[model samples]
Target: MITLKNITLRRGAKVILDGASATINPGEKVGLVGRNGAGKSTLFALLNGSIHEDGGDFSIPAQWRMAQVAQDMPETDESATDFVLAGDTALAAVNAEVAAAEASEDGERMAHAYMALQDVGAHDAPARAQALILGLGFQNPELDRPVNSFSGGWRMRLQLARALMAPSDLLLLDEPTNHLDLDALVWLEAWLQRYAGTLLVISHDREFLDAITNVTLHIESAQLKRYGGNYSRFEDMRAEQLALQQASYSKQQDKIAHLQKFIARFKAQASKAKQAQSRVKALERMEKIGPVLAEADFTFEFKEPANLPNPMLTLQGVSCGYPSAEASAAPTTIVRNVGKSVLAGQRIGILGANGQGKSTLVKTIAGDLKPIAGEIVQGKGLAIGYFAQQELDVLRPQDTPLEHMIRLARDTTQAGRLSGQSTREQDLRSYLGSFNFTGDQVKQAVGSMSGGEKARLVLALLVWQRPNLLLLDEPTNHLDLATREALSVALNEFEGALMLVSHDRALLRAVCDEFWLVTRGGVLPFDGDLDDYQRYLLEEAKRQREAIKASATGQAAASVPAAAATAPVVNSPLNASSTAKPVPRENNRTRQMRKELEQCEARMAALSQEKQGIEARLNANPALDEIQRLSTRMAALQTELDGVEARWLELGNALEAAT
Candidate 1:
């Protein structure tokens, strides 16, 4: 159990929490929630011992072991499986003692070390680690790949897996589902439900919090309030409380008004002067009930498009994927022969397992990537507003929100979509203000802003574009619950075609009228809702695991010698002779393909960094000559990056083929 008694916390001059008190009983899964920048993360820091409370007392069980995902990017050559396995600190300690004992030739010490190792389930450690990795969306083959080989997002997943692998009495997870797809999110929900420990998670996904959390701890106005139910129930309870508070406030105001009226009427009369004095004293001694200062809800809507484009976009034998680096080389097709029409007012939710080409399909439709084959027919007056999965893909970190709006206005004017529209700076500021960007924030660099701010900026840009078709990929990733709710409302009201890919089930259910599932290198309409899709994902995952296990067993049996094949094999965890079988080795070509894939990814990352650097310098309002020179280099870098990314995709395709 954890206790916080009259805890007061501050960051610089701002008081985050003032005399806030809360008690979390042992094994209670609590969802800590609040508006963005309302000190949810700051509280997590206190719990993790990163910072001490400014005043009052806070305490946790002294013997409780805590596990949390590290915030830093891991850079290591250790294989993913080995990296995750190392998270079991107790088992590692036992193994270390065993090695030391064996080196010293101490029979008694070695026996003690072995006993400790057995107690920690050393023999099953690898299986447990692999299970965690797989559940987090790692492929069976990726388990043995070096940790450094994964991209930042995948590496973060590995970090999460490692955290889950660790033995602990208390676990803290902050935005764990941000990097995951729907399938992985579903898997994680199931896993957390089974975890036998005190769990605390901070997430914007309503469904996720509701599924795994039993208690809700809300931080608001320097107060920590606990509710004995999940997020939905907490919301209901809080709304009721607010209503009661407002009623009480109204009643108090009426009583005070009556008292003031009586005192005002009697003060001038001689007979009632003494009574008036007594009334004044009574009023002075009365506790003034503060009015309910309700937090403003974020609300915004997309302006009507300049024109409605029926059959906004149509695909004909479209193979959506990445082109090859070499001009003559074949492109790597992710989703092939996609034939679908995005008509006006269509709401399509894209569903798929990770790596099943949901993003590839969206990117292709958004025109970020060209179709490898076939043709896409765009309707007359078609205008697209694309929200990329990653904010950096759509935003310049060095640019300000005002600058982005200015450029968008310029582009819209040039395209003849806004002939008579005002393109003034004041107009742009007012428009940005509608999205909650105001004052100094409008001029702040995108890189210096929080993720939610960046996301809002992206949304603001999308609304300003007045596109007839919107392609949103994980739009709610960085948004808080309020903003996400606002977005859902806005999207529902939008009079245009929409194709959304997101892990937020609430948003999906609210915005989408139908679904398109990307799987097995193709796209098709899904016949059911999100619930059915989730069941399908779970079943598919289980089938894959079984197939992999069967394949491994077959391969192991085939690899054994002819004489040894006749021997009866007894499978028992307690049998010392039943050693774990080795996984089959990768062929030379497969290994070489993996090596090339890693190299290509590294090169692409470097090129992207350099491009960003040039863009940053360009946005600094450099002199004309320097600006021209940097712009030329920036164009060249973009071309080079495009080619590198193409090569990377080609290498990825080759690796998948080998697998």
Candidate 2:
């Protein structure tokens, strides 16, 4: 349990939180929701004791240990598996010993260390570690390979995994789902649902928040308000709140106007002096509109591309990304080769495990990267509008909103592709207004705007360009869930061929018709709905993991006698405790086979039991009437189980063959 009283947090005189107060009880899952830059992270820090609030007392049980999932990490040579294991401080020390022993050169010490490793269950570490790695969307062979080789996004996933793996009384997760794909994201959502402690997550993911959060804590106008509902219900409640606030504000304004008239008229005549005084007293007593919060709704008109034609973009035997070794081994071409024909109004989503060439493929499409080899053809009259993930990089700091718009205006006579009468007044005003940008904001320098404003400006510029083809890379980054939905709606209505790279599952589902999955191995064209795409990704990843486990378990189980394998395996604690013995070379083959068979059976039994258990739990959920996070997780797990079973059966046959 934690409580905040009269909390005020300021970052350099900029009010992050003003007089915020709230009480979070043990076992409660609260979602901290606010617009971007509203200090949701700062508030989380305050609750977690990472940062001090300027003026508030936040209290919680002394026994409660709070943990925050950091968003950044220092570069290191640590493997992704090792880094995640490091999350458990206890496991870290144990793993360090094994690493140290492996590094030592003495043969005698090596044998002793090997025995110690077996006792600690180090042999099975690969299986457990691979599960986490695959669940986090790192299909990179480099995960067991090295952290130093990964980009920042992959590194963030490692850090996220570490924090999630660490046991604590309360978890303060800030955008935990940011870098995760549908497979990883769903796995994480399911894991968090069963996490045995309180959780307060700061996320713009409406689906995640709606599923995991039991309460919604709003940080607005320097105050904290609690809503007893998930995100969707919270949205409904907020609508009601805004209505009440507007009604009250309007009534007060009317009463104040009447009083002003009375005061002016009675000041000289003394006829209405008492009534005017009474009205002034009433105004003083009135709760002044609690921090006038502005509401912004993005309702944009689609500027249909001129003379748009079908089959906007096509890639046959075309690949994207820095070439992997397999691709690199053959010829000088690195990007590899893939195939796809993107048709008219194709709302395609590109998804793959991080470190795959998704960004590279999109870059190739944008002409930012050269494919090592492939074919790409653009449709006739196709114009291009590209949005990169780093909106800041794409936008000019020196440009004002109006200036940016003016720059987007093409000289119609020169290009001769479309109309050239684009004036600063009409085009600039219309574009900015489409993004909900108005008044002084139109003249404000882009450098002075917040991340959200910058993102909006980028969209505005894109809309003005009016290209027949739109390529968006993580456009949902700065936008809140509400704005994201609005953007999704706008994109759905927009008449263009869309190729978007995003980790937001909900957004992908809303905008895309097809998917281009860029695995480090190669690119695969996924022509299916969002659900099918998710299954394909997860199944592939899970199969990879099961294969790894099957290999390791075969090796591990090989040490035991086949005749003794008839006994049911006892439940073993994951922590290192069991002592293991080596099998003589003669019995090694069958013993290994038996171990693999047992491991596969155990997993099958566990999954089957878990499936039924989850079903009962779902039926008995407390908030059955309310949409819950468990529901989503249940669906994801069922998918996971399906994949697990399919693999389990294959492994079972293999074990039989070996025996």
Candidate 3:
């Protein structure tokens, strides 16, 4: 267990935590949450022993092993798998002992070292590392690629994989989902649920916290408050506490009055996920949390559009992708043959796995990238407000909010997009003030601002345009919970067509009415809700892992020495035309079939074992909810077993034919 009694922590002259006390029990998954710049990371640094408390008692179990994602950007050229494998400190220690024992030529020491190596599971370390790598969204082939070859985000993912690969009693993850796609995020949640360790994570992703954490640690006003249950439960309890404060009641009432308009709008537009009972329940909960959301520090709504077009834009067999740098080279098409219409008041969420062109489609529609083929017919006098995934795309670091707005006002007016709009400095400053950029903040360089401020600046620019259509890609990536809630409310109130690509499920659930799936070089309506999409992503990940396993098996079979083969070779009708050699040799097709057969048998055995374990748990009489979950899993296992059995039979018939 960890304990902090009357702890006072400070960064230089600023006191971050004053008289803060908290206890974290063993094996607890605690989500450390707070508003941005509330010293969450500072607290994490203290927990990790990077700094000490300014005053008071702070202690942790000395024997507990701690693992955390390294914040430093990795600069090594090591293979990804090898780099991750190095995180297994226990295995590495055992191997070092083995080497020392061998050098000493001591019988007893060598015996113990070998046993320790086996105990640490050193033989399968590479496989374990590769599994972590793949689960974090890396391809099988990329496992052998150098770490430095990947981009900054991909490298960060590798860092996370390395942290997870370590055997530890305590794991510290800070914003683990920031770089992950929805599929990877889902896989990570499942992994964390199965982890038998104490976890402390700091993340702004509400859904992620709700899914994996049971305890919430909130830091506010120089104090640490512990609450039982997940983030949503914490929010509910906090709201109740605030409601009890008589002085704040009247203020809250005023905010609630302001929020009533959004609530009415929400009621008017029924949930697109009506078929999902859980989503419907979430909608009901949102209605209850209206007042709490209204107390947020920042909130702004889009102005009424200059014009409303029935069909904002129409794609006629469009291809969304990137153009080649060389004029002679062909453009790379990611999402092709997309014939869709964006009409007034439509809210569409773009869904896809990483590298599936969700962003490409949005960029094409935002007019940042031209379509590789076909046409996009825009309504006359149509206006678009686009929020890019990267701040660099829309913001200049050296410029201030005032400069950005002034330039926007001038350019739009000169281009006749914002006819008769005021370009006066005073007018622009007032406009920026609505988005919380006031006083000297309007003059501060954009690069000096926090991520939330930068995002807010972009929103200010977009809303000022009074666009009929909004294209947003990962806009909530840097936003805190309160800011995200504010954005949700603002978006709900906006009477404009919206197309968004984001990994933030809460934002998607609140803002999108329909979903478009970008996959396999094409676009189509998903015909399902977010819940169904998550399940599909899980199944797709499983299939991909299986395919990777088969590919690995085939590679191993191909690398085998021809002379080491034990099975007799036979020519089937499929290869009857080949001339026979004097010495019998195994054909490539036969070898591949054998390898696949072996893999299938292994999978069947694993499934049977897992089913037996589930049966044992079920027979033990677990809780009602646990029983239901286990039953669902059991059914899925049975279905998979049936498919595997059918494939086994087919393989047997094929092998017999070859014989």
Candidate 4:
């Protein structure tokens, strides 16, 4: 259990929490929610002991193990599996003790260490780590790859997996679903439903909170208010309270107005002067009741397109993928033979597992990537506005909102665009005001803004293009609930076609009328809804597990041959068996070693790239602190790279001997 009483918290001179008190019972799934910068995170810090209360008390059970997703980006050459395995610090310590005891030949100590390992389930730790990795949307091949080889979003997922892998009595998660897709989000929801530990999560996703939490903790006006139910029920309770407060406020105002009027009329007369003075004193002594303030709301709509063709675009036998580095090499196909027509009023949702080519399809349609084997025909005068999942990548960090708008306008005017007319500075300011960037905010640097602000800026830029076709990839990743609601409302009212890839089920259900499933190298129409797709995922996971079990059994059986052979068996894809000849089978150990070797090579390549990036930064003259940090990180990476190279050579030699 956790308890806080009269907790007063501050950051520098600003008081975030004053006289805030709350109690969370053991095993309670609580949703901590409030407006941005309303002390929700500060309260979390207080609970985690990172910040002490200025007054009052905070307490939690000392025996409880706590786990949290780290906010800092991890820089290392550790494999994803190893990184996650390190989360169970207790299990790792027990294993180390067991190893040390065996080396020292301590019989009693070894027995005790082995018992401790068994108690902590150390024997199954690797399997458990792999399960968490797969559940988080990582493929089997990615498990052995270095953590730094993945992109920032993928690394965030790894951090989440690491947090989930830890055995904890209490778990703290803040915006856990920000980097997830719909598939992984569904899996994570199921996992949380089965968690036995206490959970306190801070998120801007209303639906997620409603699905996972049983209690709601709201911070407002420097007070902590606890509600008995989930976010939806909390909303209902808050609304009732606000309504009653507003009514009482109205009645009190009427009485005050009557008293003031009587005092004004009687104060001028000598006989009634004493009575008027008494009335005035009574009025002044009465405690005041302030009016209830409503929560702020945001609303914005996309401009109506000037031209809406019957079919916005058509893909004929399209195969989407990336091109090879060699000039004459064929492109690597990801999605094969896709034929589809996107109509002007169509609202299509792309659904698939991670790395199954959903983004590939969107990029192909948006013309960011060329189709490998087919053609995409666009309608006459077609204008497309594409929103990538990495919102900040498309934005200039050092530029202000006003500068972004000005540059966009200049580009469009120079390019002789038709849909959106050129706008001056004042016009752009008024336009940005509708999106909540008003007054001096428009001049604020984009780099200094919050995630929600950056997301809004990206939307503003997209809206200014006035495109007839919208290709959005995770557009609501960094947006708050209100902004997501606003985006859904606008998308519903949009006249042009939309191809959206998002993890927010509420947004997908609200805006998309049809669904396209990208799976197994093909794009096809799904005949069911989101619920059915969830069922499909469960069955698919089961199928994959069964296949793995069967493969393992077969490999174990094949390890022992019917009779001893003069030469060892070697299995290669290039060695095809025919009626005239037969090929030898490959040993599982050899294959495993080769895969690890490949992963090592990939890690080396990533480190080399990082080295180049550091050199470039140095050339550009970075800050002294930043330069020191980069130099230290580069040196560590180089040391790790050398170790990987040595291991790679050993693996190569072992593979050669096995063949």
Candidate 5:
């Protein structure tokens, strides 16, 4: 078991953990919850022995091993698998010992070394590596490619996979889901479920925690409260505790006020002089409970902008794609003959294979990239707030939190509302409080803040914008469980239209009212519910499998090699087809299926055009999310489409034989 006993952590003059105590039993899974700067990360660092607390002790059994998932990757030339394997230092050492013994002429040492090797699975390293690969969602052959070739996010995944594979009794995962996509997230969830060791996961993903954990440890009022059960259960208990604390606090204040009044009135009366003196003494000695805070209870209330008359944005015959004339004899494109309009109150979600152009579609709507073959018309008085997935790059490390806010403020004269009138100090303090930065925290430099804090700052600034149309690209990344839940509440209550590109299935289902499946055929509108969409995806897969099997294997060359699968789909010719269905009035399963089928037909011509357009834009601007989402989604769609074509070929063969 791993335990923290009466631990107190202080940075300079500020106290983060005051006499906090907690324990994790063998095989127990606990999720740590707190606000942005609530010392969650610090506590993990302390547990890892990376940082020492000012006062108190962390107690863990000597027999147990510990491992931490690093948030940042090393600037090394290691392959993804190699980087992950580095986490297994003990196993590597054991392997090296075995190698040395094999080289030795002594027979006794060889027997002992071989036994040690068996204990660490040296005899079956290939199988062990494959298991780790599947657990971490690195089944793609491309994962064998040099880690330097992949982006930072994928590298983070490699780090996590390695930490998980380490022969450790305790796992400390800090925001492990931030860099993972939806499919990878699902895989991770399942992997953690089967893991036998103890786990302490610090993340903002609600579904992830709820799915994998059984207990919650909350840091509040200079103490750690251990609650048994999952996140929802913990939340219920937390609310009850907060309510009880508030009631007790109010009662104490009322008693104090009553005592003071009694003392003032009777002190002058000789008959009750002794009673008054007793009352005054009682007031001084009484213990007080501070006001209860419902975990990060600051609310977001944005002033709604003027309503738009037409769709928030409209695209006409828009062909968007990136062209690589140098790589190919002809330029490659992802979207063609695509046209669509997004109106007010449309919670559209873009989905396609990794390279099918989801982020390209989002960027196109956000006005970052112009469509190559069509007009994208922005509605009048449209206030747009765009949240890029890699928005952390936009932050300035040198500035203080206040400086960042002051720069982002629309009217400097509106300063009175943000910072105290004419006093920069008061303004910064209050504004920081909205995002939960307070006391000396506002004075601290932004560079020192954790990744989670910076992410919250980004969200806080975006909320300050009060935009009418919110376009979010994975906005939920790097958030904690509590923050993600609060975000769900805020987005649900917001008045503006939301167009989100997220791999967070739970977040999308909770907030989105509609979904636009960004496919190789273009954007097709469908029932926004994740469950419904999943059913459609499964059905599509099943249909295509039947199609592929019925047709002779040599008939159609639709299957793109997985190695080349990440590239744009410019060379393929997708014939225009009729498959348009009206939007469903009620989100029933049958109605949803019919709507999806129709929308797919109506979207064929437009989708072709969108593919071409996205390809061209990708060629011009090589953004990672845009490229990956489109590529993955397009690959899934192509496999399905090939199955359909293969089936069509089989039917033709059958008809010819009969004729």
Candidate 6:
């Protein structure tokens, strides 16, 4: 259990937490939520022991094993799998001991070291690491790739995978879904659900929080408050509390008003002088309740377009892809033979798995990348406002919000003279104010601003353009719940056509009326909504896994004939003619090996199930004698399971080769 008693935490001159107390019991999944810069991260730091409290006691179990996602971008050439495997420090240590014992030619020491390896499940650590990597959206081929080869977003996914790989009693995840797509996000939610540890997560995703968290920790006015349920429940509970408080405040104010009126009317009258004095004293002694202040609200609307052009854009047999550097080479096509049309006020959601060309399609439509082989027919006075997924890529780090807007105004004005567009500094400041940038924030460098602030700035710039069509790719990636709600409201009120690619289900459900799926190198209209798409994703994943297994089996079977000897030779499956006869049955040795493989697999499965049951019992903290017995049994089972699996693989290989 973790406890905080009147903890006061500070960073420099700013007081983040003052007289804030909260208790987080073991095995509780809590969502820490607040506005941007409301000290959620600071509180996490306090829990992690990166910084000490300035005032009262903050304590967590000293023996608790904690894990957190690393913030720095890894700059090593190590294989991705190896990087994740490093998270299991105990497994690594056991492996190192085994290696050292072997080098020293110490049989007894080597045996002990091997036992340690089995106890920690080191032999299967690679498989566990690979599962995490795959769940986080890394393809099989990318497993052996160097960590340095991945982009920033992919690197962050690697970090998340590493953190998940750790065997921890307490886990701290801050914005873990920031870089994940819908598929990965769903997988992560499932993973967290099964996590048998104390989890404290800081996230702006409401659905994710509701899925994983059983408790909500809210930070407001330098005070920590714990709510009994998830984010939705917290909101409901907070609303009720505020409503009741407001009512009480109103009653108190009415009583005070009557008291003051009575005192004013009777203070000079000798008959009622004592009564007036008593009323005054009562008013002074009353405990006043402060009025509830509503949370800061952000609201904005996209300006009406100058012309609502019908068929704002048309793509005729469009092949969207990236062009090759060599002038002579053909461009690589991603989504081929696409035919689509966008009209004013149409809200289209582009749906697909990661790396399936959703962003490529948007880029082609935005004119950032030209279509490989088709025509993009633009209507008369067709204008587009694009918001890329990487907000930092479009924003100048050194420029302030006012400066960015000023530059955008100047650029737009020079491109086409639009009426009512101004480049004045004061006008730009006013425009920024609508997006919640005010006063000195307007002059602060964009590089120093939080991700949510930068995203808002990007949206503000997009709105100022007043384009007839808007192309947004993952615009809500870094935005908090409030800002996301604001964006949804604004998009709903928007008059222009919209093409959005987002993993946010709530946003998609609220803003989009139609869905387009990009998959298997083609673009087509999906026949269903977001829920249907989610089901499709799950089915697709299962199909892919089965297909991979089938492919491996086929490849193994094709090699069988080459190893046959002293038997009638059968034509190889790869080289067989259309009229080739069926292959003869395998010999006795191959058949026996196949039977052994089946039996070995069954034994391994049973042992694995038993091992898991023991581990679950251990987590419940049984008696010392029971723990020892379970541990010993688990180690023995691990050893037997390893041998059985090895033998099974050997039998499979021999059977494949001897057919």
Candidate that would win on lDDT: 1
Candidate 1 structure, TM-score to reference: 0.84
TM-score against truth, every candidate = 0.84, 0.70, 0.78, 0.82, 0.70, 0.81
RMSD of 2: 12.5
lDDT of each: 0.85, 0.71, 0.83, 0.84, 0.70, 0.85
Please write out the lDDT profile of model 3 over residues 592-642, one tens digit for every residue.
888888889999988876654444333223455655665566666767888
For residue 469, model 6's alpha carbon misses the true position, in angstroms, by 0.9
Q: Can you write out model 1's per-residue Cα lDDT over 379-417, one digit (the tens) per residue?
A: 999988988876555589899999999998999899788
Query: Compared with the true structure, what per-residue lDDT tens digits does model 6 show for residues 1-659?
Result: 99999999999999999999999999999999988888999998998989999999999999999999999999989999999999998888888999999999999999999999999987557767777877776666567878986667788999999999988999999999998888788778878988999999999888889989999999998899999999999999999999999999999999999999999999999999999999999999999988998888999998889998899989999997655444554444557899989988899999877666788789889997798898999999888889987655668999899888888888878877566887888988998998999999999999999888999999898888888899998899989999999999999999889999888888899999999998767888998987788777767555544655565557666767764723654687755668868888877877778788889988987876565444433322345565556556655666787799899888888777776
Global lDDT for candidate 6? 0.85
lDDT of 1 at 165: 91
RMSD of 5: 13.0
lDDT of 3: 0.83
The candidate that achieves the highest TM-score relative to the unseen native structure? 1
Ten-residue segment with the worst summed lDDT in candidate 4? 613-622
Candidate 4 local Cα displacement, residue 445, angstroms: 1.6
Considering TM-score, where higher is better, how would the candidates rank from best to worst? 1, 4, 6, 3, 5, 2
TM-score for candidate 5, residues paired by index: 0.70
Candidate 3 regions off by >4 Å?
Answer: 247-296, 546-659
Q: Would you list the rank order by lDDT, best first?
A: 1, 6, 4, 3, 2, 5
lDDT per residue, candidate 5, 1-659, as tens digits?
77778889976677889998888899999999877677888888887888897777788788888888766666777766666666777778887887788898678988888788778865444334444554443433433557665556656777777787688888899888877655456657766887888999987777788889999998776678899988878988888988999999999999989999999899999999999999988988999788875554655555555564467778898866543333322223456667888788777776654445676677767877667578888888777888887676678988877777777763635643333223355665686687778777766777888776787788877776667888898887776555666777888877778888776777788888777776654777765566666555545434433443444233323465756857766645542334655554544654544555555554553444444433432432346665655445444444455455555455555545544
Q: Candidate 2: deviation at residue 592, Å?
A: 21
